[model samples]
Target: MVTDEDKVFKALADASRRQLLDKLRKKNGLTLGELCADHAMSRQAVTKHLVLLEAANLVVTVKQGREKLHYLNPVPINEIYMCWIGQFEQKRLQALHNLKQSLKENDHEQ
Candidate 1:
């Protein structure tokens, strides 16, 4: 069982791993070699990143003949957003709106 926090932070920990996720998000179902070509890291490093992503369930791999293609599994990411950002979005927006209204009132008073 993968916890939301574990998946979210682990997936976001490494810049290179984030880049790999971005690439997969844009053009999913890419082979390991295809992903490696886009970055400067060696194949082994990319594989390590992929392992982390996979462990987090942030990525899924499929075998197509001789190649294993990787795809971004967005469910975990969305879960994180809902757990973290969704909880605060309404309050944050209300605070911003209140601040704007206060500023407007102050400007009119001046």
Candidate 2:
């Protein structure tokens, strides 16, 4: 069965989509025209990518007086991090913290 997480991963798998997400991250709310302004992709291509992003729940849209503004929704990404990546990183983070403390102690003693 295809899951919500699956959708997010699939949407993020494309470089274009990821770039679109990056653009949205830099500027939270942008209209289609604004997003398409400096892109190599055509308007139709951008629209298709936006559709995938919306399906993944990674992008959301709001209509404001005729213009549709696209915004990045970070909840799904955070959830994925917390559920998957964060758990694995906990040990590595602790190791890094320990290493930092050791380095600091060694420097102070010397």
Candidate 3:
């Protein structure tokens, strides 16, 4: 089963999509034309990338007047960090703590 996390990872795997996300990060809300302005990709290509981003819930659209504004949603990325990356950090921290304790013990015995 393709999970929501899987979708996020897949969407983020592309460099173009990452660039789009970076653009949104720099400026919270942007229209399709704005995103395509300085980018190498065609407007249509950008639209396709945005579709994938939207599917992953990495990008959200808000209709302001006649323009559709795209915004980056940080929640999915934060969830990934908390669930996947944070667990590995805990193990590394524990190892460092153990090493510190071992060094202290050695110093006391010397």
User: Each candidate: how many clashes?
Assistant: 0, 0, 0
lDDT of 2 by residue, 8-50 (tens): 9999999999999999999989999999999999999999999
Task: Single out the weakest 10-residue window by summed lDDT for candidate 1.
Answer: 1-10
Give TM per candidate: 0.74, 0.77, 0.76
**Arranged by lDDT, best first:** 2, 3, 1
> Cα RMSD (Å) between model 1 and the true structure?
7.9
Q: How accurate is candidate 1 locally (lDDT)?
A: 0.87
Q: In model 2, which range of ten residues has the least summed lDDT?
A: 1-10
Candidate 3 per-residue lDDT over residues 64-108, each given as its tens digit? 999999999988899887886787688888899899999999999
lDDT of 1 by residue, 26-109 (tens): 899999989999589999999998998998888899999999999998887787678767865879887999999999999999
lDDT of each: 0.87, 0.92, 0.92
Model 1 compared with the native: what TM-score?
A: 0.74
